[model samples]
Target: MAVITTKGVEKVYNPDKIPVKALKGVDLEIEAGEFTAIVGPSGSGKTTLLNIIGGLDRPTAGYVEVGGEDISQMSDNALIDFRKEHIGFVFQAYNLIPVLTARENVEFVMLLQNRSKAERHARADELLKAVGLEDKVHKRPAELSGGQQQRVAVARALAPKPTFILADEPTANLDSESTANLLDIMARLNQEEGVTFVFSTHDQRVIDRARRVVTLVDGKVDEDLRR
Candidate 1:
């Protein structure tokens, strides 16, 4: 199934004035359970494209569908609800709250979804242990290593059991060992949990791991290669 798709999609920041079209007539489809990479140079609309697909931004034209729903047709409130229900995000920087423990950080996402306290704690604990952070669950992000922090972020993103995950340069700040560990974790999730990963990245390691690579150039697709 096509979990995410766009056709003739466009995002124009200034339509009347000097228009800045971040995504220009982008047409693409990403299947469920696939590990895919959206690659391009800076400002080529890779992140914009991900935002549109994830319903973080509206398209000026064309269709944007996620899990077969026309997300562009949804109201702002509905889009927020939809995202919380189905989408997960992992950014390059580990956006963990320093005041919170690793378990709290993971539990936060579930709490946002109005999950019960018991359920939240259980899910967070399971995820933290899965990421090899069981012993450090009581520690804050500041106390953990960079790799450990990133692992916590990943665990947090998966706590909601989201079908689709949008990761933007997730390995950008990591060392070689950390990047490899993170990539391995992501691969394991895709294989074991059937989580679909679609990431925007300039990193070659990410592209190499992807089952499909979509190349963007000048706000349009230059190529789509499937492994």
Candidate 2:
């Protein structure tokens, strides 16, 4: 099943004045249970496409559909609610709340969804343990190592049981060991639980781990390779 679809997607900045075309009529289909990486040099529209697919930004033209719903036409408020329910985001920066412990940070989104406190606690503990942060569940972001913090971010992303995980430069800040460990956890999840993941990354470590690589250049998909 195709989890995400983009047809003739285009994104332009300052279209009336000095125009910057970030994406030029790009089309893509990302299937369920795939570990895919969108990779390219700087200014290749990788992040732009990611933002569009994740519903963080709207396209200037064309349409985007996720989980069979056309999100391109959704109002800003609707997009926010749609994203909250369907998309899980991980960025290069660990975006965990510094004031919250790992478990609380993981539970934060479920709290927004008005999940019961017991349900939130149970899910947070399960996710933190899944990401190998069981022992650090009570530690705040500031008290954890960089890798541990990223683990918490992953746990938080999974807390919502999103249709797919969208990650941008997720391993950029991690050391070799941490990156490897994080990749291992994600890969295991993808394999065992059939969780889908889509990432935009410049890291070779990340690219090597991806089962599919889609290369973007000059705002278009230059290559799509599956291993």
What RMSD, rounded to one decimal, does every model reach? Answer: 1.2, 0.8
Candidate 2 residue runs with Cα over 4 Å from true position:
none
Model 2 lDDT per residue over 1-227, tens place: 89999999999999999999999999999999999999999999999999999999999999999989999999999999898899888989989898999999999989988999999999999988899889988999999999999888988988898999999999999999999999999999889878899999999999999999999999999999999
Whole-model Cα lDDT per candidate? 0.91, 0.93
Error of 1 at 135 (Å): 1.2
Q: After superposition, how far is residue 155 of candidate 1 from its true place, in Å?
A: 0.9
* lDDT comparing candidate 1 with the true structure: 0.91
TM-scores of the candidates in the order shown: 0.96, 0.98
After superposing candidate 1 on the true structure, give the runs of residues whose Cα lies further than 4 Å from its correct spot.
Answer: none
Query: TM-score of the candidate numbered 1?
Result: 0.96
- What lDDT tens digits, residue by residue, belong to model 1 across residues 1-55? 7988899998898889999988889999899999999999999999889888888
TM-score top scorer = 2
